[model samples]
Target chain A: MKVTILGCYSATPRTFTNPTSQVLEVRNHLFLIDCGEGTQVQLRKYKIKFSRIKHIFISHLHGDHFFGLPGLISTFRLLGRESELHIYGPKGIKEAVTLFLKLGDSWTNYPLIFHELESKDTELLFEDDSVSVSTIPLDHRVYTNGFLFKEKPAPRKLDVKATTKHNIDRSQFNNIKNGANGKTANGVEVANQKLTLDPPNPKSYAFCSDTAYNETILPLIENVDVLYHESTFLESESRLCQKTKHATAKQAAQIAHKAQVGNLILGHYSTRYKSIDLFKEEALEVFPRVALADDGKSFDI
Target chain B: MKVTILGCYSATPRTFTNPTSQVLEVRNHLFLIDCGEGTQVQLRKYKIKFSRIKHIFISHLHGDHFFGLPGLISTFRLLGRESELHIYGPKGIKEAVTLFLKLGDSWTNYPLIFHELESKDTELLFEDDSVSVSTIPLDHRVYTNGFLFKEKPAPRKLDVKATTKHNIDRSQFNNIKNGANGKTANGVEVANQKLTLDPPNPKSYAFCSDTAYNETILPLIENVDVLYHESTFLESESRLCQKTKHATAKQAAQIAHKAQVGNLILGHYSTRYKSIDLFKEEALEVFPRVALADDGKSFDI
Candidate 1:
């Protein structure tokens, strides 16, 4: 799995820094998270294929989170896209997007579906055979949700040498891989473990942003392989975090430390800061493993 | 008056090129015209002060023309703006923008007034002591209106030397500038022409975009100091121009030639083209004075 950060700055987009938007590539699916203003231009700059974005997950209704959605939707129509597009966002998102289309009198030529989310508790959002996605309810000024993506375990691998020694027929290889016992050619029963090996463990990733330091999400994201949390301020601005309902770098690190996540990625730095290194410096004091998310940075997990 | 081209390309915005958006500086007011997707970032790049822009004029409802409006408005609120903002556009704009604000629950702290336009004929939209803005109805796929900005003729310049030679009293200077006869100290009446000189001719600019090759606007824009017209295609692609409701460079020049405009600026080039010089070359074939609009390029009128 790979995660590309198109933009990670807080508030408005500037000439050099962009707002919050990222692409997570997992299980052959590219899911867009929190499309901020100017996201389509950043996508074009990064050379990410526009059509690959089949599903979009919005965290909230803030302009910095979903302002670019309308333009991206309109761009798809202009490009003559015929594939179905799905949007999972806050409850009012459907009305906000469709109203603009209605006002412009330019409806999409393809199927455009919106899944408005209003659940206060963690719930499943999307699922397929290979992967599943659920929400991590977060505490913020408005209703917001972070997504969790996990890979499903695959079938056990066939032990070719063991199967050959047991004289297992090729027809039974499928069943053997499914943890079934096989009858040898000499009429002896072979144990399933003798002909099969365990598959690799599944991996999980959690995305959290634009929230306060709430421990309620710790249970939902505990022990995740990777966790991306928003750190919009530093300790100096901790006084404003409470009123704004944003987290500081130290707070984000403390959450990662308590959750025992394997890897912690910090993003959504306020643009007022002189440098992002301060966030890393502060986060390192609490959590040893930390990565600062920057525009166009890609992380492999 | 000065005009700055923030983005003039047609269709979607690319890495190097932008869509339709410009800043017209006239009479101490920074008027924003047609805010495309990434206009706020472009405004920052161009170093145009945001607070000075009190009025925004949108030509139509196309995404490339006005999609940046919502983000810009939200940014104003984030910046803690207290001044009122006025928007002039098509009828549905008010509902479209207000709905988005309601969805996010992020209404602006300042007053937002929308002047929706539904007229198909020339109509006055704004007037002040020194300037007036009127609409130039155009033919496009949607209800579109181009804008005509005219600087009201300045009061005639007082001929200080002539007034002194004629022994005109200082109290009569105002009357002389207002085209009234001036009285000399000896009670002799002097002609206003002798005491005053004609002020520089009023300058006018007409902005026509996303429209077909229609000649009805010729009367409204005739003898203007400058004209910025959309040229979305070359003569070779004129066939597509009709279907897309856009004009070719040659066609734009034809309108400028027929209107007897002082200078013609051709823009909104299709992204398929390699260079912008072709637009100027094509337009120059029909109009003597032609300039091609490019992103970040500025022109003084």
Candidate 2:
């Protein structure tokens, strides 16, 4: 899976900093997460094929998280898109988007399917042959959900050398990979372990933002290949962070460490600090494998 | 009066080109016109003071015309703006904006007043000590209006030297400025022309956009000092322009010439062209002294 960070700053989109938006490219699918203002422009800049994004997941209704939704929808209409677009967002997203389209008298010619989410449970939102998505309940000022994307395990790899030595027939290869033991046409018992090797490990990614330090989400996101957590403040502003229901750098690192993720990505820095180095320094002290997310940066997991 | 063009291109906002947006500064009031996407960033890049903008006028509901409005409102709220903001637009504007705010659950601390407009004839929309604004009905894909900003004639310019020569009493200065015959204590009548001059010609500016080549607005914007009209196409694309309810450069110039305006500014060019010089070249054929507006360019009328 490849993760591209469109923007990472918290609060608002400014002349220099943009709000939250990212793209997760898994297999042939492009999943857009949290489209903030200027997201379409960013997509254009990054040369991302916006029409390929069939699914969009919004964490909440904050301006910084989903303000660019209407513009994106309008752009799709302007471009004459005909494919169905699925949007998974908070409960009121349908009303908001529908009102905009109604007022403008500009509705999409394509199918616009909205799945309103109001529950605070690990509900599956999307699943295909290769991947599945679920929500991770989080603590925030309003209803918000963190997304977990897991790539399903692949079929067991074939031990080519052993299979050749054992004369495993090509037609029986599928059964061997499926861990099925069967007798050969010569009445010889061919064990599946001798014919197939272990498959490559599956990868998973989790996204969390605008939330307080809640331990409940650790288990759902634990052992993921990558975890992106909002680090809106540093330890110096920890008091204000909790009061605002936002997490500090140290708190984000602590969660990542407890979850035992392979790599932790910290983002959504507040504009109060000119330098984001303090966040990296603080997070590194707690979780050594932490990296600060910069706008337009991409991570391969 | 000063008009700053924040953006002038038609259709979607691109990284290199923006959509329609302008700032009309009359006396102490800063009026914003047609906020498209990236307007806030344009405002910041142009160094326009946000707090000074007391009123915003939207010409239509097209995304290219007013997509940036909600973001600007949210930014103002985040910046702690307390003064009321007056938005004048079509009838459905209030519903669209309210729905966005409701979904975000972000209410502004400041008063947001929407003066929804629905009229087929000339209607007064704003007035102050120095200027007044009236709407000019426009023909477009949707209900649209062009704005006419006329500066109330300045207190007739005082011909101080002429007044002194005419021996006008200081107490009668006000009367002379109002084009009245000033009478001295000795019953000597001073001619008004001898004491006062014409009031700086009473400059007026009209903004006409997203409209076809219609003659109905000529009378409303007649003899204005300056006119800013949308010229989405050159003469070569006049047929397509008419189908889209947009004017060609020649058409804009024809309107300006028929209205007998002092200067004509053509804008809202389609991005298909590599340059805007063709618009000016085509417009000048019908009406000389035509200027093509560019993003971040300014015009003083």
Interface Cα root-mean-square deviation for all models: 1.0, 1.2
Models 1 onward score TM values of: 0.96, 0.94
Flag regions of model 1 displaced more than 4 Å.
A159-172, A182-190, B167-187
What tens digits encode model 2's per-residue C-alpha lDDT throughout B274-301? 8899899988989988998999899999
C-alpha positional error of residue A264 in candidate 2 after TM-score superposition, expressed in Å: 1.7
Model 2 agreement with the true structure over A1-301: per-residue lDDT tens digits: 9999999998778777778999999877899999998888888888999889999999998888988888899989988899999999999899988877777788889999999999978899999889999998889988999899999988778787877787667777777777887456677987877777777788899999979999999889999999999999999999887677999999999999999999999999999997999999999999989888888999999
DockQ of 1: 0.74
Query: Distance (Å) between predicted and true CA of A112, model 1?
Result: 0.8
- Evaluate every candidate with DockQ and list the scores: 0.74, 0.64
> Model 2: residues >4 Å from true position, as ranges?
A169-187, B160-192
Where does candidate 2 chain A have its weakest 10-residue lDDT segment?
A: A176-185
